[model samples]
Target: MPKLNIFVGTMYGGALDVAEQVKPLFEQAGFDVTIFEQPMLEDLIQHKTDVALFCVSTTGSGDFPGNFVPFVRAFHEQGPALSELRYGLIALGDSSYGETFCGAGRALDALLEDHGATRLGERLEIDAMETFMADDEAVPWVEQWIDSQQLKAA
Candidate 1:
């Protein structure tokens, strides 16, 4: 059975809410899902899941949320290659921030790629400046991604 892990880095809790919204959908697809808020690097290093989904909100100046600092630091210091991991990212940002919009997500995605993880699909960037919330886009994206995964499996 393939396992799925959700790790969220949030300021003001919006990304966490989005992650919670998607948990059941992954479960319904037969993935054993585990969710974490601002997970530690050690936890990620030892994760048993085959797939990882990140729901992260960029903070001021496009920085990672405060709670993500330790994890990011540890990963840069000595994280091993995640050669067997498959991952996806849902970046929550306000497009009004201009170039820095979704910076944290892009940084994390780059880190994951540097560590050799395979991205499951295009990184989903949700604009908080839009009329709709991030989950609006995320929900449908997850549905489609799941459908594609199922098709590939078949």
Candidate 2:
């Protein structure tokens, strides 16, 4: 089975909830899914993750959540090459924040790309001002993502 790591970054649990909501979907699609509430760079390297999903919520002034800060710092400092990694991103933020909306997710996307990771599809950006539940948007997107990637049970 293909292994999939879901990295979650949240301040008020929205991103975590989104991750939980989508876990079973990935499993149903034949992916061995793991959700990391507090992600670490070592988790990626040690587990040899090839495919991943990032569910992150932008905090104050577009800052990363406290739990996610360490992973971001480690990734930036260590600068591991991720040419073999494929990823999808879900960014939660209120659009009212303007340019800073989903800032953390956008930054992470760029960072991952810079490190040679391939993005499987377009990033999902959930606007808090419009969606009451992020999963509503995330679930459909994930389903499509799985289909687009042609993921099947091993």
Candidate 3:
């Protein structure tokens, strides 16, 4: 079985809530799972996991939550190539923000792709403006995502 590592960035905790909710599902799918909140670049670079999951929220004006700013900078400025990585991303934001909605997630997703990381599937974007409760909407979406990948949840 492969490992699944979950990382999240959030303001007011919405993205963190979604990460916690999905952790066990990955574990049940026979992955050795680890979760991080506003992780450092070293935290991601050191791990040799088969899959990395990101749940990140866009903060004011599309900025990354304060805790994640350093990680984002390091990812763009100093992170190593990640050709062996496979990933999934969950972008949490209010559609009312228009162009900036989920900007942090999109930025990270592009960063990873640029470094040669492959996506497990399409990124999941939860619209807080539409759902009111982002985490609630994320649960089934994640389950279906795992299923769509044809991954066995042992």
Best by TM-score: 2
When summed lDDT is taken over every stretch of 10 residues in candidate 3, the lowest stretch is 145-154
lDDT score, residue 120, model 1?
87
Q: Give the per-residue lDDT digits (tens) of candidate 1, residues 53-88.
A: 999989998899987888899999997789988888
Clashes of each: 0, 0, 0
lDDT of 2 at 58: 98
Stretches of candidate 2 exceeding 4 Å from the true structure: none
Task: List the candidates' TM-scores in order.
Answer: 0.94, 0.97, 0.94
Full-model lDDT, candidate 1:
0.87
Model 1 segments more than 4 A misplaced: 151-154
User: What lDDT does each candidate get?
Assistant: 0.87, 0.93, 0.86
lDDT of 3: 0.86
Q: Model 1: which ten-residue window has the lowest total lDDT?
A: 145-154
- Model 2 lDDT tens row, 1-154: 8899999999999999999999999889888889999899998778866589999999999999999999999998999999999999999999999999999999999999999999998999999999999999999999999889876665
lDDT, model 2: 0.93
Using lDDT as the measure, which candidate wins? 2
